[model samples]
Target: MRKTAPKKRRWSSGGLAAKQFSAKMANNEKCETKPEQSEKNEVLEELNSQKRKFDKIAEKLQSIEETVSKIAKLNDDEEKSMMKFKEQIESLEKSNLLNDRSNEKLVTRKSFVVKYVFENLEKYKFDISKEEEHFSMNWHMEMQKNNGYLGIYLFAEPIPPFNDDWSIEAKLEFKMIGKNNSSVIKTGEGIFEGLDGNGFDDFLKWEEMREDYLIDNKLTVEVNVEILKRTGFGKNNIREFDESQKEVSDVILVVQDTKFYVQKMYLALQSSYFKALFFGKFNESEKSEIELKDIEADDFQNFLELIHGESSVDDDTVTGILNLADMYDSPTAIRRCEEFLLKKSKKSTVQKLQLALRCNLEHLKNKCLSKITTISDIKSIMAANLPEMDLSTSQALLQKSLGFWDE
Candidate 1:
């Protein structure tokens, strides 16, 4: 019974001692674990903050990559747009058209008259209008009539065929209104067919005869009435007259609205074959008979100096003569002037000399004789400043005039 009571006490003591030991160990472990857990929590918190910053930086990188791609695409688009604009601007610049009146063609038929008969119309004459254009020269002279037309040409002539030596015959083929169809045509066949050579002189003689006949007949008679009657144009072909029964001084042309008073005078002179009349140096006929056509150009110029002596002159004709004289020295022209130029004005005589010299007319030197003043005047003329006078002459008169008689 005593042992049993003590057992309960022993049990209680043991249980209480165990419980206290357990409580003490548990407290020590709690103290050590609490500091370690706090350090781990702080490390984990810092890791979380670092992870959030990394996530933000990664998002920013992705946005920058996308923006870079957009910028690259924009750059490509700008380049392409600039290229397209340059191409469009180049296509708009190269298509433009001239405006002037003188460049136009001559339109009227009535504008074909002149001082000389046109070599083309051998049978038909030209018709002219009243108003004269500054650039146009068209007028008509009365001639023989053929068919219903009063003209110098029977038909237009063709240019010479391959074998024909006469090339001037081709000019007649100019365009004109046709007789039959009333349309433009080139039916250029002359009514007269004759070989041209020495035979051509006969044609010229025929033309001269025809011209003489017309002039003589018209000068002596009221020929317009007969001409109108012959043309078969009744009252429509009437001629105009003055109150005094005198024919109007103006020429009546085919163009109905116009008339003009253009008169031409031709003067001819006689040449001597012997008996030097002016200064006894040379005969006029001998100068004329030198056959300038046969002489070479230089020889002819020397001959001009011998005949004309020395002269002062101006004009294209004189220039041409001086050139020819410098080159050929035709004695015929030169000597002719020396014999002829006396009692003539320096102006008119010099003018004639200039013209004859230029035209290469050995015969015309005689026409300037009245212009010489003195031997000094001749020397002055020789010394006068002229570009073309720079040639040596064989004529004694010219040599003396130039102070080179010894040379």
Candidate 2:
């Protein structure tokens, strides 16, 4: 067996070369596999990013749709409300109860009340021409509740050297009417007095004029009135009537200067009594010896010329005379007022200033048809115009026209 050991065989050149080629191929496969794995991981990350972006876009679209729906609903509601308001306005128009002419209606009401009161005064024979009247009334039911009630007020323009003390008197009587109509009530009275100048400063004067009556279960009523004239420094003198004879009732008025004996009578109306019967104007017939200061002779003569004027005089001429009198503080202003009262119409009511400022014959003629109620009103109006007439004295007159400190 020791002799049989074979000699070691050497490798072939081709076989070794083949073995090296196989090793190079295996390394190339490993490198290609690693690059493919890296590319797959990058593709997966890109897909996830695209999916997240799509989800955000979808959420935004859903929010926009909801907002659009809410906006459409709000628009519909507004349109409905507007239609309802329009319909209501049309209904009001058809009814004619709600008015478009509210200011006109208010003016009508004021004018009507004034006319009513004026007529009532005429029935009372209060000599609207000689005596002054003042009043205030409620504009509404609510005003009546809060401010009491409506009343007609009467007053006199105090004679110069005016004093506050004045007399006021009132009386009342009533009678029941026919059958079951006893529920209706009427009243009558005989004397009334105006407050003195001081009444302007105090409202209690109004309370003194008011009166109330109580009846026992009477339904319908009527009344008769008799007012006698009497005068005192602070109170009125009332007369007692003989219950049997209605005609003989009378009273005497004693003023500081003279005495007035009057026979009083009354007339009946729907809701009130008229205050006038017949009165005779008389001056001191007998007792003339007492020497009291007489009204100045010039004043007395001028007063006569004013109320009873010559008819042929021109209106502008009178206006000029009055304006000059006002400037110099003459009594002629009172005369002009008397003339204006005699020749007044609706058109001339607001022309006091116009005529005074332009003192032309044409302007004065035009003013002939104005409503001039009182001398004081005209004088006040003319005085108000003085500043506007002369530019040189305008500033001074303007200060005066603002009215006195007392006003």
Each model's lDDT comes to 0.27, 0.28
**Which digits, one per residue and each the tens of the lDDT, describe model 2 over residues 97-141?**
212322222111101111111222212321121221211111110
Quote the lDDT for 406 in model 1.
Answer: 28
Off by over 4 Å in 2: 1-162, 168-187, 190-337, 340-407
Candidate that would win on TM-score? 2
Q: What is residue 156's positional error in candidate 1, in angstroms?
A: 51
Give each model a TM-score: 0.16, 0.18
Cα RMSD of all models vs. native, in order, equals: 57.9, 50.0
